[model samples]
Target chain A: MARFNLGITDVRKITGALTEKGYPDFAGYALMSLKLSLEKIISNHGFKESGAMVSRIYSDDNFTDSLIDELSVETTEMFRDPSMWRLLRERIFPGIFGTGDKIKFWLPGSVSSEDLVSLIILLKESDLTTRSAIILTSLSGKSLDNIASGVFRSSKMEVSEANYTKFQGKGELSEYMVKEGGKFFWNKNLFSEVTFSLGKSHLEASATCVNCIIFRDKMIYMNLTLSNKMLDVICRSLSGGGYFIIGSGESLTHTLFDKHFSQVDQNEKIYQKIR
Target chain B: MYKAIIIGGSAGSFQVVTRILSSLHKDFPLPVLLSLHRLKHIRSGFVEALSLKSSIPVKEPGDKDHIRPGIAYLAPSNYHMLIELGSRFALSTAAPVNHSRPSIDLSFFSAAQAYREKLIGIILSGANRDGAQGLERVASLGGKTIVQDPDECQVPVMPKESLKLTGVDHILNSSQIIEFLKKINRNALD
Candidate 1:
């Protein structure tokens, strides 16, 4: 019952701004989250446009990075979900990709390379690296640059290393990255087959006949409308019976996608493109 | 109507949760969302263990699972589970808060945003201070707050932190917590 400044009018203005930029469901799905992010921006970098009207500051570089960072879900540890990774290693990899088969993996909204490290290490250990090609795409060119640089904040190294240990990943996980002052830069050589693109993302690709398409935690950041759009794009990208993985907590029961992807290992949230 | 029951804890709390849950039947009226800290890389059947201990059906929720009554949903390991706008669970692999992936504070705070005062948040025994601020947030929003009596706790740090941080409605032992829940169920029926 406390008075708050943000109301319907501010939502309309911000919604209008985002819609004008061709994004959907910001008003519905991500409104509160966006408002929370803007609140943090105001708290962090003093308010340029005060109280309920953060539309003006939405385009600022710092503000934009903060928004994407707030919305995107990329703090995955190396082998974060052990069962899912184990499933991938023990079952999904062998079941999907055969010998001499080239891997055209479509990884969209991969702002950070933690999940990529887990997947690539899987590929490397599986000896699929020689036949693999990973396409990492994101909306922000800046984040892609960070991914390309292969550097993670030094503070995160401890947790990532610990997770790698739990993953039973052999050799040194630290060997994958070199520490430069406060940041740990990943070895570019490790991702020799990975491609990073700024615009015209993997989701935009039509009929991408690929081995695996990972559209994980990206949906959690997006509004329902955008998530549906991305889901449709993912469905279009994968051929019938191709491997597709999503965030384990994500529900793909949206009626539009139900006919497209048959739930395989529902607990792991892996779905096979049935159509 | 109360939309959900949010429980958070870490080390030494599982048995307490199992004890509380065992007393509740499969027809328990509220959906229980748990954001317990767990090892990120180890594959432990923690939910399965709890399911066996309790009559209530327990499962680690997938991303965006509809919040439903009569079932207890555990936050998936390596993801910070959130309550989305439409009574759905959204998982985020965002940076670990308090060095925990399925951070208790994240669940309590995000679930508070959706359910507001129509939710119950309970903090139980644990080693870390993950859920203290979150329990405070729940109480401040007019939602009910309970913490395990730290004296009875196997590891007292978590509940002790909650008691210190917030004006919790109850500081109960495991049996008392079950009684509290049964009382709620009875009140709902009445």
Candidate 2:
């Protein structure tokens, strides 16, 4: 697990390897970061040769999915960014789901299931699991499966529990989870109404109107044209008066984002789709 | 050949950063990326505060904003700022590294990959060891590395830790750091 330096030649080789393997679109993205991250994965997984690694990634869908999984950011926990989570729990959630109305949620780029589980924890508190449905989707199918299976490291649970406590939840965070060996799993029974899908684009790509689109932090990879394109789709897909939350640092300057969604919570990057 | 400068600091590094930035020539032709740990909340105008003493404009770049010479870009709060080899920047909400959101290591490593020997990395005063290892990476990649001399730092922990590890190109104090940058800017003219 020694850190290695990559030259421009290595970047070109890896970018070409990825593009050659059917993901030609990733070349313009953070290819070097992905390259180095993949190198770390390759070393940890005992794939000594990157050429052989690329071949394995092409030959096995599971390997590719796992690679995608490794590349995703998993630094999430229950009620992260305490103030924002508290706002969602106190103000946003009750306002959106009062009176037991049917509500729909779409979480794009739902990385490593932490954010999804956190939201489910909030839903459980409000007693909205039965009346609400959440579409947890990512470009990689494995992320959706990970959400469905709910496998995560046991050590991570304590950190998440602390965050939940910080948010002042009604009960212990682990009360909703089932632990096995070194990992913890969420009880599927508690969130049976939630559905998992590999959503290719934003919620706009889907046929259904989403009441809340939590596309947070996913726009960081997209350029302006792509961001606006997805924003257009988000505006089209979001139900009137629905919420759209981007990353804390991610308010695109595109005029359309301003025109289509009004900033409801600037610090939290929460926007309300205009009626 | 250096096209950009990357500065990483935390805790008490702001004053040193503003000082160095303020002393740079207004027409300095290198994009400077400032990676300082910041509060995730407080969405408005950290860049504006830094720009008050700066000769050149300071901006907090959006996710895909392109880097331009003569401008200083502050890493936005709660995100990891990464360079894309070209003049453009990309950001990530990836988990914090070194217990920091704008982890100095993330940017230093990424900039090393993109700019290699053509980048200058500066580590300033901080309470934590976030930027120390990243400076090693920058130096290893042939990029020039500078650490603020520990004695003159507001908080010496960061620079002292970095000095313990790497034989960086320069170890400078606050005023010396400004003089060093001024020298680099002058060298660019020649």
DockQ (Cα-based) per candidate? Answer: 0.39, 0.44
A56-132 per-residue lDDT for model 2 (tens digits): 76688777766666766545555656667788888888888875679988876676676777777888887777778
Which runs of model 1 end up more than 4 angstroms from their true locations? A1-42, A46-62, A82-102, A124-130, A154-172, A200-203, A263-268
Task: Give, for candidate 1 chain A, the lowest lDDT window spanning 10 residues.
Answer: A1-10
Assess each prediction's global lDDT (C-alpha) against the native: 0.73, 0.76
Give the 10-residue window scoring lowest on summed lDDT in candidate 1 chain B: B39-48
Query: What DockQ was computed for model 2?
Result: 0.44
lDDT by residue (B1-190, candidate 1, tens digit) is 6878999988888888888788886678999888888877544587878888888888887666678898889887777888877887777766677888888987887777778899899998899989887788788778989898888888999998888878788888889889989887887778
Candidate 1 residue-wise lDDT, A40-134, digit = tens: 44455555444333554355555544454444546665665556777787778887676556768888877787778778887887788877888
Clashing pairs in 2: none
